[model samples]
Target chain A: MAAVKLLNCFVSPFGNRVRIALAKKGVEYEETAENMVTKGPLLLSSNPVHAKVPVLLVDGKAVCESLVILEFIDEAFAGTGAQLLPADAYARANARFWAAYVDAKMPECAGKIWKVPKGAPAVEEGKKEMVGVFKTLEGELGEKPYFGGEALGYADVALVTFTPWFLTYERLAGFSIAEECPKLTAWAARCVGENECVAKSLPDAEAVYQFVGGMRKHFGLE
Target chain B: MAAVKLLNCFVSPFGNRVRIALAKKGVEYEETAENMVTKGPLLLSSNPVHAKVPVLLVDGKAVCESLVILEFIDEAFAGTGAQLLPADAYARANARFWAAYVDAKMPECAGKIWKVPKGAPAVEEGKKEMVGVFKTLEGELGEKPYFGGEALGYADVALVTFTPWFLTYERLAGFSIAEECPKLTAWAARCVGENECVAKSLPDAEAVYQFVGGMRKHFGLE
Candidate 1:
């Protein structure tokens, strides 16, 4: 096997996506934690365009972008442990669609909770939008144990990384995700409890809350 | 082979992305052009979530999102005509990265030109941002004939859909893309000349210009 290394930031849900994927595949690799505040030379050179973390370095070559890197891992390590995406073409496309949906909707909706004043109209609007997004996702999840249906697959991996942030979001936004989307919340707990990869990789929710709280202060939001 | 159908809007570059990919694969399919002003039942039913164009229906199953549809076409029709994405994992990841970059940057930057006032400082700022994006893409292209290096591939298919709009953008923004990123501009011209799929699928630049002009007028910009 070619030597593998992952450049990641501890607090990033994007980085955790890679970590969980790697763990699921049972791939042994070195991980280097990066200081997002003061970016180092390796990160700058590896991801010159995005300058973002969760870059998977294979031997000497670098693969940037978490989703792209996830696809690469699945493709390159096809014969290894677990399959991240589905084998069926249509199913894989479905998984990709939902994963992309999570990416597109999460940041903007979640950012408002931490970035905006609590009493602001934008925060309330953001909460409404976030609920709508979660509701759509819940509909997609339907009766399936996982978004991939029976297995903790692509969409599961893509979304479970955000589970830790639920607490932070609930605390800041003043609404229970469990109250609004019980099935989705239950699915998240199932992932954390049942999946070894998810269990090992997810950080403490309280830690994430503290981290995000510090971030709000740093940005002069609190 | 399953019956394939594409629901699209004529003016959407996203729909055009799926169109070009299907054309490249030499797949015979039915296409229905939707009315953007009042979306029809099929469009609404097929993609209930986003309610957007570029829905690929295969054997009555709908695949929404243009990028996902492109990947589906590539995977489902593998070993048919031209390969949309590269076979090599690393190369495919690179193609995906740039295709995603185009998706992320194009809407905001290109959108400003048409959405904002003709002589607004924001339009100029948008132009500058667009040039920067093109320069980064140009650097990615380097001296290669295509983004896929030797052949028209995923990134090429993803981006060439926007070529018709370049003339409209240039005319609207009062800037020359050819002057700003000559290599990328030349590459676009090369794609139109060499690729039958692109040549046949791309609408005329003048027609796009007229369409956009009408759209601006509809919005009371002109």
Candidate 2:
């Protein structure tokens, strides 16, 4: 019943997070795709601090940062649907820790994959680090089927969006994420296959691959 | 009552956040200084992911990451003392955004002060960006006496610890933060002056200056 609107760029993993969170909560709202390069007024007004995508506007109130918005959705719509985070305090803290790790580690590794030219030696190093990043997550995943442990919870929501980027990174760096991190690869597949929210919210991996190629060209990296 | 132990380096702002948060909650805990460089076995085992400092051990369960620790402390000891975050969901989300800003923006800006040689032109650019960072916070602070409105809240706890580093940055960069952002200066002073926990938790500024100088020399950055 609350008016919920999201300002986002669809191809963004960060934007995918908000979509996944809202969908999990069964919150219906409007979403606008903001041009990230050209300054958009709505995004500027909503998130004056970062001016970044995935700004959730609830009845005109704005929540920025995908992780914060996930927490917001969980808290604001307390009774809505499945909670992204765990109910136990310690478990919630653990989930937050891994989610923070995903944010801290992912972008740098993901960027290196595309930032380097296809045949460059740097691409090899980038692939090594990218695989390392996934290996870390795979180690964390352990015997648990999901990062949330039997549920598609906070960290699952946090990380699954970026699986779409795996195609882009793998192709650019000439490495196979599925081969490097089989368990994590399987887990990602399970998230997309099992969770309608995750499946629907995430952009197609092929689309992400095309976008990354275009972006590298646009930024003169290509 | 849970058994709480903190593994941290004294000068780290991240460590200070945990100390302040614990003190705010009236929680009694053991403090062990961890060598961030050598990284003791306790820290390694406690935080295998990052192997970084400021890991909170509650009943021997390791909670890594300062911000996550802060949230854990708030939730784990619900009835102990003042809540770090606001009760309202919107306000809580806002607090998280600014805290994340402090984490994302501060280290990079603060690093430029010490990471560069004192006389380098990079210091001037760093100084400008450092001032810009403060101004953004000043703008966010607006007419409020505290970021939490009435008292030392989450964002306040998140940022106040970094004030000790300001002295070193200003000394190295030759720019006065007080002049650049008077309101934030006043607010920082108020936090240190008013909050006994903050006053005791933060390392002395002069000590930080010496540490930075020594570190620069050790790293061959001078």
User: Cα RMSD (Å) per model?
Assistant: 1.2, 1.3
Scanning candidate 2 chain A in windows of ten residues, the lowest lDDT window is A111-120
Q: Model 1, range B134-210, lDDT digits (tens) per residue?
A: 99999999989999998998998888888889988898889999998899889999998998888888888898888
TM-score of chain A of 1: 0.97
Q: How much of the true contact map at the interface does candidate 2 reproduce, as a fraction?
A: 0.94
**Model 1 in CAPRI terms: which quality?**
high
DockQ winner: 1
DockQ of 1: 0.93
Give the clashing pairs for model 2: none
Q: Looking at candidate 2, what is the lDDT of residue A181?
A: 92
Which tens-of-lDDT digit does each residue in A156-192 have in candidate 1?
Answer: 9888998899998888878999999999999999998
| CA deviation > 4 Å runs, candidate 2 | A116-121
Q: Return the TM-score for candidate 1, rounded to 2 decimals.
A: 0.98
lDDT of 2 at B128: 88
Estimate the overall C-alpha local distance difference test score of candidate 1.
0.89
